[model samples]
Target: MRILGVYLENIRSFRKGLIVFPPRGITVIQGEVGSGKTSILMSIAYAFETPTGGRVEYADAFATPQPRHLLRTGESRGLIRVLVKQGNRLFLLERVLQREGDRVVNSGNAIYVYELLGEGGLQVKPVLKLRLSSGEYIEKLRSLLGLVEKSGRQRPEVFTNIIYSPQFNLTSILELEPSKRREVIEIALGLSRYTDFRANVSKVIDAIGEKVKGVQLELSRLEDTLRSLDKQGLQSRVKKIEEEKARVKRELEKVVSAREKAEKELEDVNNDILKVNSVIQEKRGLISRLQQENRLLRDKINAVKSKLASYTQVLGVSLDNLDEATKKVEEEIRAIQQRELGLRERLNALITREKDVIAEENRLDAEIAMLERRLGEVESDYREKEGIVKKGICPVCGQRIPHEHGLRLLAELREKAAKIKEELEEARRRRGVVREERSRLRSEIDKVQAELVDLSGTKDRVREAEKLLLELKSLMERVAEVASNEEAIKRMQQEVESLEATLREKKEKYASLKNELNRLREAERAMSNRLSELEGELRTLNDQLQKIQVLEEKLKSLRSELNKLVNSREVVKKVADMVDEVSRVLAQETFKFVSESFTTIFTMLAPDKALSIELSKDYEIRFYYATEKGRGLVVLPSGGQQSVASLALRLAVNQALRAISPRLKDSTLLLDEPTIGLSRELVARLRDLLNKLDEEQRAHIVVVTHDTDLLEAGSTRVRLVLREGATQVSYEGELDKNYRAFVESLIEKPP
Candidate 1:
């Protein structure tokens, strides 16, 4: 697989940029410090997997940062698009930071995979979706790129291994820790795939164990329940309950039968009693009405007798003579009433004249009092004004005054007061005359009142006489009526007494029937209670048996599950062991292939040293200095040898990982400045090694370097210049005449 180009939008120092790799030979991407050469590689890394370890890819310069700081300065969103070609197919992978709000948010964390189509048109459309949605897409991508599914594909794992190595990291794999060295070796021989395969096998084994444990627990519980079931005892109890339930049912039937019979008798008795009660109620009502009529007739007889006796005593005669006496009394009452009416009229006339005279007297008296009060007010005012004048100020006018003016004013007030006093005296004289008139009218009013009282007394006498006459007449009529109905009333009293006796007999018969009905109902209720109790007991026993039957069925199902899981556990264990053995074999084979490559490359890079690669059973890296020398680390004594050996190991690894997947197999290596930090003597040796590599063409290596001597005529150089904080990368096709001359001067070729 080869990276054709990379497009970065809102990524560190390259706001929007594209860098394409040359199609053939070694493509060198060269730049000064901080020219964003490293950032371009990082952008590619972000497109594949984010961050690429120990770096916030889009956070510092133009990237959309994470969480709160997603977008960098002036960047609201960011995108990284990497184009890679494998065989005849090209894929474009784009990772976008979809900013949703003012602040940086994770709305843009989606990745879209596109396939480039239509010849060299560069038109691409989405083929897949990835990023936070699921990890399956990432696994698919790794497979397409010919990478180990679970390998942490760092820069060193792919590009930096043989193609692009930033400064300071150009060392042999042998100098790395044992684990890291092992990782490189294993990747080289495609053993990482087997390692992942082994891990999956182990996971299967764990899952089987967990299922086995759950099944075992259920089996144990089932066994415990089976042991505790007491089947024989349960059977015995069921039989007993069955027998008892049958007996209860039989007894319930008998009781229910008895209850039904008693209820029928109670119903018959209740009907009989209801009829008796209805007839009794009608007779009782008739008796109550007759008794009420007899009581009223007796009361009338006593009232008539009382009035007859009163009239007899008042006139000393029986009520039969009361009509003649009443007529005589009525005539007397009319004559007396006429005389009393005339006296009342005369008294009323005198009273009306007296009221008029008294009203006039009261009016004259009020006017006199008002006149006197006014005169007194004027006198008080005159006195107050006299004092004010003495103080040299008129009180009424609120003015200062001299003594002569004060005296004049006081004299005028005195004269006005005297005139008011004269008027007050005249009002008093008139009031006294009116008071005399009122006294005369009062005496006349008392005489009239006396006459009225006399007439009223006469009227009361007439009223009493009239009332006496009416009573006498009423008593005479009632007495006559009583005389005529005495026999009939006596007959009604006797009939009432007979009805009461009949009502009493009927009520007694109703009571007797009601008692019998109550007795029958009580017996029926007792039987019903007995039946309910028996039925309840039977239902309870049946419920218990049903629950036990359900539990028995569940136990059988649990045992079946236990049998299946136990079989699965055994089979899974065997598979786990087999996978382990396979992983070991693969690891050994991979170590051998990589060991041979490491030794051959190290010898080529440092011919004088002649080192050999060694591998321990645990895959630890070591170098045998010579066939005669003892076992040691794969590290070399010289920095140049160490750098060459590490490069060889990394190349071997990248080659293996790339070749493992059919689609991504390629012979491309991106190596950064390996000539850095080396002495001129060492650099010359590195140059010699590069010349041999160019001749061999075993791999296509893209070097990013300031080592001008490494550039050659056939090399396609991607020159990067620092422009406005961004690295402006130009491919060979776009390199200008003067720029090419400038680059050529800096590149030192092996003569």
Candidate 2:
């Protein structure tokens, strides 16, 4: 897969940028430090690989960039759109990142992959659309790029380790320990399958050995158990127990029959006792009820007699003279009630008359007040006219007036005042008369109230007489009820006596039944104990018979399992030997090719320095240099040499990947700051190496660097500069003029 172009928004230091790469050539991306040159390469990788997306269990934490730092500072959202070409197909991969709480997260639904369709690749069709999780979108992209294995598992290292080498990580593989380096090389070259297979076979061998041990132990245990058991003896003992159990069972049957008879007798006795108890309880309840009734009747008779005596004393008569006394008391009550009625009527009339008087008096007072106001007005008018008369002018017209006219006005005002005074006097006299009448009515009301009070006293005496009369009537009725109560009392007493006698007879019968029940319960207990003892013996014998049968079956199963385990162990050992041989052969062949390629690349980059590297059967990398004093091992090298050696090993591994997988032959080689810590001569050699790869079309080489030496190596050269706070891009060769205006126009526009 080759990246054709990349578009970024708010990614790292870029607010808005677009980088278009040549289809197949060495493209050198040159820029100052922090000019966002590496961001363009990162954007391409980010489209198919998110820092936090996908299955992270197999991912390298240090190698992956943090999502929190991917977005531009002070930005809430970022975008990475990459257009890639594989074979004749064009795919556009996009990934979006957004701020969530305190961290940056990928927008799952915003990630998409679309196939560029139709002519000119203008029309688009979705390959992986919205609503899909970010992991799903990334996996789909990996499949499209042929970065997924046949087992439906993702091989992200193929893209990250072989296809792309991130900034400052060009020599990362060389810095790892020997074992880790071997592991990385194997995975990159697709040789880990053989190692993995050997590992699995070893595990299988160990498991088979454990199974064999377990089976052997179980077989030994079964043999020991078989030796300990004596079948003849067990059979003989079981037979003896059976005979004894049979004898006991015969006796138990006879006892059970006897126990059943006893239980039946006990149940019959219990039933009889229950019946007797029921009859006794009924008799006791009846007697209690009759006794309570008698007590209530006696209390009522006493109350009635006491009330009759009180009435005789209050009325000054005996019970025989009750009629006359009641009649006299009723007449007195009637007389008192008549007087009360007359007084109430008179009092009500007097109250009504007082109300009328008060209303009339109020009216008189209002009229008198009105007259007094009129009189005062007239006097004020007369005084005002007198002053006008002295001036000898007409007050209304403002003209001179005669003195006689003024004097006449004064006399008229005085006369009006006198008349008002007389009328006010008359009103006052009338109001006084009304007040006097009100006072007389009130006096009459008070006198009637006094009379009503006197009547109330008489009413109290009448009420007393009426109470005596009511008592006299009650005494007569009570005397008759007294005779009836005495008769009922005698009857209830006789009933109580009869119930007591019946209760005593039932209690005696209940006692006799209880004694019989206890005797039968004792006999049943004895029989039940004998039956339980026999059942226990039979249970013990049956258990022994079952145990012997189970042991025989288990012995057979153990023998079969032991034989199978022995055969499996042999087969597993053979398979392990075969896998080991294969792994050794494959490892030799793979390492041979990788070591040869490493030697060739390292020599080409450092031809003057007689340095060479060797790959051992264990995947150990050893560097050797020849001098006048024969050959010496390169124990420690300078930064430049280390970079050269690391680059050589990485390129050799890339070659191995291409040689093994046809799909990876045309994959892009992304190098970020590969010239970092390298000498001037080494940078030139690297430039030549990259150009040779491009010439042979081994891969599409894309390099991000700050070295100007690499500019000549690129067929498509691009320059990045930090402008204001964003990155700006410009091409350096044939397309410079054409893209300059377009790039400037883009930068001039708002982001």
Candidate 3:
């Protein structure tokens, strides 16, 4: 914990700075490139992690500028101050950054942390507070610059001493990138148990690739439901609806046999009108007895011609004309008294007009004998309506007779008894023409010769009305051939009962549609055997998911090639035990001053070129070449003698780190120009090994040079004199007055 003292203002090239380090050995702050001399070792590594000299931004070894552009950038504001000493406990910290309204306020809020304690020896003074306000005095100046130490009990989890090895970068260790150089050498070798075994095998292969993508998405939805149940036919459509219900029940039956032969020809015209109504009641009783004997034979022929004309006129006269007449009628009784006095006044006017013409011929012979007793009561009602139409109905109301309405009422009663027997044969032929004129006036009376009596009952009533009209037209043609064979057996019994009721309803709807297509073909054969046993268990889980993805890519390439062969065999056994502990601490601290500073920088840069140099165990430096008689050793490619044997072994590892913490580490030695490519006699033998250190092994020997022969081995010299932008150092204590005024400003070659 050292940073003895440092105070800076506007920090970058450090404007108003002051420095002091004298706690032990080296304290060099040589200036050259941009003349600030690594700004006094970067202001003591930014006051050893910002005592309060705040802007080390959080220390990757300090770079937090911009306190208003660290002041000289057109001047804004910046300041940094630091002073510390832990053992004797003196501390003074101050840091302030600004750029207010636009903000970049490092906000150490005008910090102040003082602690100068000494008490008995009486050097006590400060006890001030605001130590970087809450950053706890920059974490107590990073635990008093052991940088951040305190974890003792073997707590080495890799914090390589806040390493700030700047200069040209090693490309962060030879430009990493071999898996980031095995993650920065496993965080510089802490190796956190192989990074938790590669993060638990990448979380168990991401949960087994999400359970193999959910078993291949449920086997692609059961193979699309077994290919839509084999492209849908759905079982033959129930046998074409049972063959169209057996052809519409054979056809309805011949229309029921023409409606039963028009009801048997209307029953044979009702038995030929009941025998023509009994021959019209026997011709109406013979025309009512010839109209009453033709009015009694015309009243006996006018009584013999009226008594022969009244005896020839009462015996008087015209006897002379009658003498010939008397001779024949005295003679004919005078012609029957001229027809018996005209038939005695026509038999007294025919018995006084036959008593009203025999009372109008017995009132038309009692109206033709009451129309022949109403034609024998219409022939006993036409023989009881022909025995009620041969018993086929209507006896007085048992109604059937439509044999064409009983043959139209027996031809209208035989035309009303043949017109009353032809008006009784024209009244008996006018009574035989008045009895042949009274038998020729009875002069010859009784000449009778009547023998015409051959009436076989009028030819048996006209041969029984022509044999009952030929048996009613042969019983109406046998009832129209038995109603046309009972209408062809009721049309084949309604086509065999409608094809047995459509074959019993198509065998009960095709046996209930083939038992519902055998329960949908056993649910499509149990969903096609459950989609072929889930596609053979998804093809045995896709061959066990491709053998667990090729055994998780060969277990991630054998755990990244076994963490790169166990970090290259632990960085090659920690570079072979750090090159045997750095060659036994460089052979106990110098190794003959690193083999005489690489044979005096390769004999001042390749004298005759059979060069030689070598060191290993990781601090690495080698060069070899051989030809003249020695075999070929060949590796001498002098990049300026390997930059002057790596700047003289980094100034002998900064004087062996001030011979190991000469009091907590700040022995500084920074060389920037480093002799670009050494030549001037190898830069005067690298300033003759930096003047072979003496003043307590060169306690404050700072030497930065534009090579006026290494500032002529300056005891104390300083000279950074830029002009217009204002920077001036120019001091001298010895070096023969700053090496003869820096060799007269380099031979005045101010070209």
Candidate 4:
């Protein structure tokens, strides 16, 4: 695809602009550095691949920070309507980037994009739009040098343009790690499978080593634990049993002391009975004295009554009356005496009763005291007896309590006495109680003793327990001496040992496996390395083969081309012999080509001292008069000469490309600052070249420059100047009667 013309507005350095491209040949775009020469090239790259290749706004390609600022700061939108030619069809690639713009893709207002094509004097919308669907446009555009297709290890245009090379990175390329170096080399050589193989091999080797180390560590820990288990044996049981036996012996002493206390209480109750008997005797004597006194008083009162009766009888006459009165007196006196007698008798009876009661009470007290004393003595005796029994002392005081056991006899005696005393005390308490109540209490006491017997019958259980403990201790000791019988400790030790052994076995197995796996991995790594080497060699051979194939094809084509020159070889040889003359003639032709019409342009743009242009076999340029005389092309000190040389070389390359093949044809010429080092006369000669092109060729030429010295009458002139706060395009075409007249006015005026 070829760009015939572009109507650009408010693009990067072009503000409010419309510039057309000529169809072919050298079309110089004389411009300063900030002018819109590169803008035209970028516009072509954007319009073709807008979504992926370039920014949406052409101003985004510059330092303008925002989209709104791209359009003279206040203008709302920008448009670059591109007129492109594909094959026989001419189509428009319009790109409109607005802040609030409606979406028009490629060159249309519809959802589907279309390109405007000119055919038969009519502008028709063609299906060859700038979209993924337009594969043909991409292919044709790539055929021209405008579109670049990068492949393989070639850096993409994006990275090359965006990334600058630093010295550190350049040095680091040689200082890469072994693996990293291999990786970069693999990438450069395109060895994809070998890279994956080497990575897998490294992982396998690391995994095997990890497994081996883990197993070995586990085995070592297990062996250490198992070794300590053998020392923890079964001698602890004996010490534990001896401690228990001593505890039981201490408990038996408590039982002995308890029995002694019970006996002492019984003795105290018996002593109280003895004291009561003595009190009963003293009360009996008092009862006898009171009874005797009562009898004497009654006899005396009876005698006195009889005496009174006799006196009354002896005194007759009035004595009868007196006697009667006396008798009455006697009777009354007798009655009073009788009453006193009766009172005395009652007092005696009361005293006797009191004595009897006292005696009885004393008896009871004595009995209770005796019983208590007896209980105490019995308890003391019982304690003594129990002590004798436990110490194996004699209980009967004469015969030793033999194999039957002295403690057993004493214990039996104490138990029987205790039961009898308890019954006796119970019976004494119920001395005046109902027979049934006494019987019931006795029965209850019996029941309690029976329960005690039942509780004590299992006393030997503790002894049996002690015996069993001894047996256990002996068995444990034996087990320590001989290993099999000790199940608990032995089993634990065995388990620890088994674990140790198994861990050792596992570690050994892991070691073996790891060794095998290592060997396999090493083999695999070696194989991978070999494969990589082989593949690298194969790729090198293939690249060499491809180069050789390309060379052979080139050689064949060259020979075929040279075959055409076979008849002209003599002429070519003659020309080759006169190389110096040919060189001189070529230099003259180059000078003539540049100094003829374009010399005036170069002279005007350059300073007065240096103004000439040098050309070579490929139209290579050297700034001679532009800087210093006979200065090499590279010796141009100013950036302006470099810009001029760049512009000239770009034009020369396009021309050569077109001349080589019609398929390699390019119609657009973007000359950036073509008249940077030229005089007004040289600029005028260059202006003639610009005006000399035919209308078809003129349609494709777009000159972007700050220099106005090369403006001509036939060209469409646009002047870029800062207005308000931004750049705006003004038509110099209408500034004067002609473009040359308008541009010359400034130079014509005094500096």
Best by TM-score: 1
Tell me the tens digit of each residue's lDDT in model 3 across 91-140: 55565665666554556632333344444322344444454543565565
Ranking by TM-score: 1, 2, 4, 3
Q: Regarding TM-score, does 3 or 4 come out ahead?
A: 4
Worst 10 residues of 1 by lDDT: 742-751
Off by over 4 Å in 1: 9-15, 22-26, 32-35, 46-81, 84-108, 115-122, 127-164, 184-230, 243-566, 599-635, 663-669, 675-702, 708-716, 723-726, 733-751
TM-score of 2: 0.48
Q: Which structure is stronger by lDDT: 3 or 4?
A: 3
Better lDDT candidate (2, 4): 2
Best by lDDT: 2
True-structure lDDT of candidate 1: 0.60
Residue-by-residue lDDT tens digits, candidate 1, 298-400: 6765665564464446544454566676676567668877776776677677668767867876787787788778778888988888778889997767888
User: How many residue pairs in model 4 have overlapping backbones?
Assistant: 70
Ranking by lDDT: 2, 1, 3, 4
Kindly provide the TM-score of model 4 when superposed on the true structure, using C-alpha atoms.
0.29
lDDT of 3 at 190: 25
lDDT of 4 by residue, 1-751 (tens): 4555445566666665554433333333444444555555556544444333333343333211223333333445566556555555554554555644533233321111233344432233435334333334434444433333322222222211111111112122223454553343223222323335445545654554555455455545545554554222322433443455455445545544554554454455445544544444444444444454445445544544444344334423122233344344344444445444554555455455545555555566667677777778878788877766666557676455564676467667677677758866774665444434435545555555555455444433333333333333343334333233233333444444444454444444444444444454454455455545545554554554465556556555545554444435444445444654544554454335433423443443343564557544333445553333554444543654544343343333334333333533545444434455555665665566555543433324555556757556234555555454334444443222332332232112211
TM-score of each: 0.50, 0.48, 0.21, 0.29
Clashing pairs in 2: 393-401
